[model samples]
Target: MELADRVESLTPSTTLAITSKAKALKEDGHDVIGLGAGEPDFNTPEYILDAAKNAMDQGLTKYTPSGGLPELKDAIIDKFKRDQSLVFNRNEIIVTIGAKHALFTLFQVLLNRGDEVIVPVPYWVSYPEQIKLAEGQPVYVKGSEDNNFKITPEQLEESITDQTKAIIINSPSNPTGVLYTKDELEALGEIAIKHNLWIVSDEIYEKLIYGNDNHQSIAEISEELKNHTIIINGVSKSHSMTGWRIGYAAGNETIIKAMTNLASHSTSNPTSISQHAAIAAYTNSEEEIERMKEAFEERLNKLYDWMMEIPNLSCVKPQGAFYLFPNVSKIVNQSPFDSVDEWVKQLLEEEKVAIVPGSGFGSEDNVRLSYATSLDQLEEAAKRIKKFVEKYSV
Candidate 1:
C-alpha cells in the first residue's frame, strides 16, 4: 500500500536524526558528545515534580477538559498578564501537550489548503514541516546574518500574497538564538496589521535569554496587533519540563476554540498530571528558572569565547537560549569536505562529536551547537571540534 501523500511530502527532522545517531553510538561504546537536541540539560525542578505527585495524591489523574484544566488555564492567563502585560479570558487560552503540539494544532485549525504561512529563515526546524502538514505553503522571509539573523519589515511585507494567512515569528530564535527587540516587533506588527495577517509568535525561549536582552512578544506591541496575534509558549524550555509536555496558546477566542475542538478529537486532553505540574511551574518556579538561566549563561559565555578562538568558524554570538550556531562555511571552504553535512559526518566519525548542520535549518553553511550540556562536556566537544577542523583547515 502507498503511504499518504502528506507523509511522503514531509522531511524528517534533522535534529532528531543527529541526536538518535549520537545515542546509537553511545550504545555501541563510542564516546559521542551530542550537541544536537535543543532540550535543556537540567532536570525538572523538585517543586514541579512534587506538584505532579501531589496531583496524583489528590486524585487528579482523571481526564481533564480537552482544552485544559480550568486551574491550569487560569495560571496561563496570569502568566501572560504577569510577563507580557497581556490579558486573556479562559476562552482565549488552551493548554497543549507542548509548544510543538500547540503550534501543530494552530496550523491545522487556521490554514486552508494552499494558504501560505510566512516563516523567517534559519528558523526552528518544525515550522515549515507543520505548515506543509496542514496543507499550507511556507513562504520564507530571510533573516540574514547581517541583521543579527532577524527579518526586516520590508522583507516581511515583500513575502505576503493574497493567499498569505499568517507569519511565524520566534525570538529568541532556535538555531540563531537572537532576540528580537521591542522596536523590531513593533515594526513587524505594523506590517501584520497592514495586511490583516495573523502573527504566530513563538516565545518558547522567552525565559532563557542572556545578559541585558529581553523577549518582546509581538502581541504586546499594540492592541490591534494583539487581536491579530497568537502567542505560543510552554514549560518545556523554561522550566526544564520537556518530559512533562505542557504548552499553551493565547489568542483570539474563536481561533483558540477551534484549536481546542481539534484537540478534543485528536489527543483528547493533555495529561492531567502535566497540567497540574505546569500550574506549579508557572506559579512557583521563578527561582528555579533563573537558576537554569544562570547555568546556561555561564556555559554560553565560555563556549562562545572558545568557538571565536577557532580560526575558520565564524558565528553570530547568540543572545539567548543554550545553543551556539557557528557559521562553518570558512572552514568548509578551506577543507576538502564537500559540505557542512559531510564535515559534520567526518567529525562525528573521527572525534565522536555530533552537531546539527545548517542545511537542516534552511542554512547550509552553519552548524548549531547546543551548550545545554555541562561545561566539562562542552570543553571536550570544543577540543574535539578544534582538532577536527585543524586537520582539514590545512
Candidate 2:
C-alpha cells in the first residue's frame, strides 16, 4: 500500500504512543502505574455535563456553521475579555475538533513548502510532525534543564532566518510544564514584531497552572502582538473534556477565516453538541476549574517532592500543568541499557511503571511523568519509580 509522501515524513505522537503501550500492559494483567497519560483524572464537572445533555435534549445535534455556533463564539470572546483582558470579534474565533485540529489548520493555511517554524526543544510531540505534514520545516531551539527548560529571547532572535515563518510558544508547556512570564513573553513579542513572525501561542493548559504563578498569553501583552498571534485553547485540559473533541483559536480575521475554510472542508464545524457545551464551559463560573486546579497542585507537589527524594533523579519544579519532566541523564548513562528508551522499557518491565522517555520529546537525557491520575496512583507510581532508580544507583 502506498501512503502519501507527507505521511512518510511524520512521526507518531510519542506521548499517545506511551499511553497506548501502558494500556496494553494493563490489559495483560500487569499492575502497571501509568504516568504517561496527560488528561486530568477528575470527571467532567456536573454543570458542564448537564449542559451537554441539555444541548442534546434541545436538538442541537445538527451541524453548526463551519466556523462555530455564534453563541459559542460569543462565549469565547467574553472568555478572552474576562480572563486574559483581551478582546476579539466573533469572526476572529473558530472552533475545531480540538486544539490539535486548530493547530493543523493554522499550519495548512499559513505555511508554504520549506517555510521554517522555530519550535523550542522538548516541545509537544505533535508540533514537529504537524509542521512536517504541512510541508514546513521545524527548526528546534534547544532549551536546557539549567534554564528550567525555557527558550530565551536571545535564542529566538538567533534562530530567525529568511525562511522563518513563525514560532510556537507553549506556556505552562506540555512536556516540561513551565510557564513563560509576562516579561519573557514581551521580549519574544518584540522579536516577533521586528522579524514579522507569527506567534502561535498554544495555551491549552492555561488554566491548569499551579502555585502563585499565572499563565500569561502573549496576546495579552498588547493589541499589536495580539493581532499577529493565534491563540489556541480548548476545553480538553481545563474542563477535562478531551473526549468531547472541541477546541478553538482566536486571532486576526484573515487567519481565522482561512482556518475556518480549511475546517469546513476537513471536519466542518466542531460537533454541535460539544460547541453548545463549550458555550457553558467558557461562560460559567470558574469554581469547578479552581477546585480542579487545587487538586492538580496538591498532586504535583507530592510528585515533585517524591522525585527530589530519589538521589540523582533531579527535576525542575514545574510551575504549571500536570507533568514533571525530570532530567534522568545520570541514570541513563549509569544504567545497563544503551538509551533512554531502553531504560524506560526496562523500568516498565521490572517495576510495572510507565513513563515517556525524554528522547521522544527531542531530549535524550530526560523523561516525562504525568501526575494527572488520582493521588493513590501517583503515590504508588512514585514509590515504584524510586525503587527502580535505587536498583540502578552505584
Candidate 3:
C-alpha cells in the first residue's frame, strides 16, 4: 500500500536519527559519546516529581477541560505576567502535548493548502516538516552566519508575499543557541506588523539562556504586536520536564479556541498528572533551574574554547541555550570527505563521537554539538573531534 503523500514527503528528524544511531552503537558496547541530544542532562527536580506523586494519590487521573485544567491555565497566566509582563485571559491559552504540538496545531488551524509561512533558515528540524504536514508551504529566509545566524528586517521584508500568512521566530534557537535582542525583535515585529502577519514565537528555551543575554518576547514589545503573536512555551527545557509532554500556546482567543477545539477531537487534554507537575514547575522556587543553567554555561564555555583550538573551524559564540553550531566547511574542503554529512559519519565510525550534520538544518557548512552532557564527556568529545579533524584535514 502506498503511504499518504504527506507521510511520504516527510524526512525523518536528523537529530533523532543521529541520537538513535549512537544509542544503537552504545548498546553494542561501542564507547559512543553522543553530543546530539537537545535535553538537559539533569533529572526533573524533586519538587515537581513530588507534585506528580501527590496528584496520583489524589486520584487526579481523569480527563480535564479540553483546553487545560483551570488552575494550570491560571498558573501559566501567572508565569506570563511574572516573566514577560504579558497578560492573557484563560480563554487565550491552550495547553498542548508539547510546544511542538502547539506549533503543529497552530499551523493546522491557521493554514489552508499553499499558504506560506516565513521560516528563518537553520531552524529547528521539525518546523519545515510541520509546516508541510499542515499543507502549508515553508518559505525559507536565510539567516546569515555572520549575523550570528539571525535574519535581518530587510531580509524578512523581502521574503513576504500576499501568500505569507505568518512567520516563526525561535530565540535561543535549537541548533545555533542565538538569542534575538530586544532591538532586533522590535525591528522584526515592526515588519511583521506592517505585513499584518502572525508571529509564532517559540520561546521553549527562554529559561536556558546563558551570559548576560535576556529573553524578550516580541508580543511583549507592544499591544499591537501582542495582538498578532502567539507564544509557544513549555517546561520541557526550563524545568527538565521533557518527558511530561506538557506545553502551551498563549495568544488571541479565536486562535486558542480553534486549537482547543481541534485538540478536543485529537489529544483531548495533556496528561492530568503531568499537568499537576507542570503547575508545580511554575509555582515552585527556581533554584534547581538556576543550578542546571550554571552547569550548562560552564560546559558551553569549556567546550567552545576547546572546539576553537581545532584548526580551520569557526563558530559564533552563543548567548543562550546549550548547543554550539560550528562551521566545518573549511576543514571538510581540505579533508578526504566531500560533504559535512560524510565527515560526521566517519567521525562517528572512527572516533565514536556523534554529532548532527547541519544539512538537516538547511545549512551545509556547519554541524550542531549539544553541550547538554557532562563536562567530562564534552571534553572527551572535543578531543575526539579534534583528533578526527587533524587526521583528515591535510
- Per-residue C-alpha lDDT of model 2 across residues 98-181, encoded as one tens digit per residue: 999999999999999999999998899999999999999999999878888889999999999999999999998989999888
lDDT of each: 0.92, 0.90, 0.94
Clashes by residue pair, model 1 = 358-363
Model 1 CA deviation exceeding 4 Å by range: none
Sorting all predicted structures by lDDT, with the top scorer first, yields: 3, 1, 2
lDDT for 360 in candidate 2 is: 77
Compose the digit string of candidate 1's lDDT tens values, residues 1-394. 8999999999888888888888888999999999986899899999998999999999999988999999999999999899989999999999999999999999999999999999998988899999999999999887889899899999998899999999999999998999888998999889988999999999999999999878888888788999999999999999999998899999999999999999999999999999999999888849989999999999999999888888877889988888898999999999999999999988888999999998888999889999999899999999999988899885
For 185-294, candidate 3 gives per-residue lDDT tens digits of 99999999999999999999999888888888999999999999999999999999999999999999999999999999999899999999999999999999999999
TM-score of each: 0.99, 0.98, 0.99
Q: Taking the candidates one at a time, how many backbone clashes does each contain?
A: 1, 0, 0
Sliding window of 10 residues with minimal summed lDDT for model 3:
208-217
Better of 2 and 3 by lDDT: 3
Q: Which has the better lDDT: candidate 1, or candidate 3?
A: 3
Cα RMSD of all models vs. native, in order, equals: 0.8, 1.0, 0.6
What's the true lDDT of residue 95 in model 2? 89
